[model samples]
Target: MCFSASASFVGSAGIALVGVATLMQVRTPRTLLFAAIPILFALHQLLEGIVWLGMDGRLTPPWPQLAGQLYVFYAQGLLPVVMPMAIWLLLPSGERRRIVPFLLLGASLSAYNLWFLATLPTDIGQCGHSITYHNPRTREMLVAIVYVIATCGALLASRRRWLVIMGLANLAGLTVVALFRTWAFTSVWCFYAALISIMVYWHFRRERMARHVEEAPQDHHFPAGNGP
Candidate 1:
């Protein structure tokens, strides 16, 4: 959760660096989409920093409201779709088909949430060590369950070990936030997700290294006649 400007800034900077490192490890355009997750999360944290500033009265009028809306736009509107799509893209050809249902579910959830966000009124307030985003229309048990299935489900469906671990971590985070800090679930969960994204960097780096090692023998080996 973005409790203060400093926490938000620290998270933003740290995740930004991890994002860049993850991007550099990308082997193809397909992987690039998933690699960008940390970068997007970094931006997400930055937006929350603005929201914090606005709520604290450190920012001018309208900016706080605008920032809060933008934060929700990402938190509620875009992520549901993007998370599954990213995982879907990262899956192997055989596994890709299996994730379609989750992808569709995510898209549907995103659409419904976007509509609700646009049509309903929203309120943001500080509570305890977190910020609470109030949008009654968007909060429902079914919706929350579907959201978890769409986002975390896709990751869990992945054949990649690292992705499965990431999914499990996210599920744990979601469960904790929902159980204890339902009011601040969005903020708290996003923070947890952003932190977990460091695993993305580790995954990519490991893959890249494995690829290098796999190619090393081939590069070193040569035709018998061509060998010096």
Candidate 2:
């Protein structure tokens, strides 16, 4: 189904809310940073939608255009930087060896942004009749591929099986969206907005699972006169 500007905004708002709620599941060192990634991503799409509605096209003019461009660049690039840092902090000291692959993956994706900026024309007319400067669908497909690789690398290294499953599922979904090219809307922005909304829902489900575990009392007995 096609999404109007208001609907897009509402979807982003839900995503942002879910991201924020996910952060509250625990006060881990990585929680805020990791959760913020999705929120920023959701907001990035929301702002792009607002700009599209304002400009009546994808390649809007002036500040909003630049702002959206910058946001996308950072979201695509910096998220990798931050995700590895979060995973590093969460990993056990003995498992520090696992961090190498994640670092390499994140760095490689971050480098793609630099290469894209250097090789691609940032000129206004390069893309037209749409809300993005480049062919957004093409760009998004590439970004999804990079994320698939990076997250897969992380999942493989992660001791947690759930992370592997979730990472694989995310990779599969993004790959489908990229390859099939049959989205609910013609607008690439709308497709991303919808895709990210599904991701936000998945994050919420994870948060609920975390809460359930936290609420459940532990039955293990500690040594007498000693406590955790």
Q: Which candidate is the best by lDDT?
A: 1
Clashes of 1: 0
**Tens digit of per-residue lDDT, candidate 1, span 1-228:** 557977998999999999999999997898888999999999889888888888778998788788789888888888999988898888777779978999999999999999999999888899987988888877888888998999899999886788899999999999998999898988999999999999999999999999989888654665578555
Model 1 Cα RMSD, 1 decimal: 2.9
lDDT of 1: 0.89
lDDT of 2 by residue, 140-193 (tens): 655656665665566556766655565565555555645654332124533453
Model 2 RMSD, rounded to 1 decimal:
6.7
List lDDT for all candidates, in order: 0.89, 0.56
Root-mean-square deviation (CA) per prediction: 2.9, 6.7
- Decoy 1 TM-score against native: 0.93
| TM-score per model over all chains | 0.93, 0.67
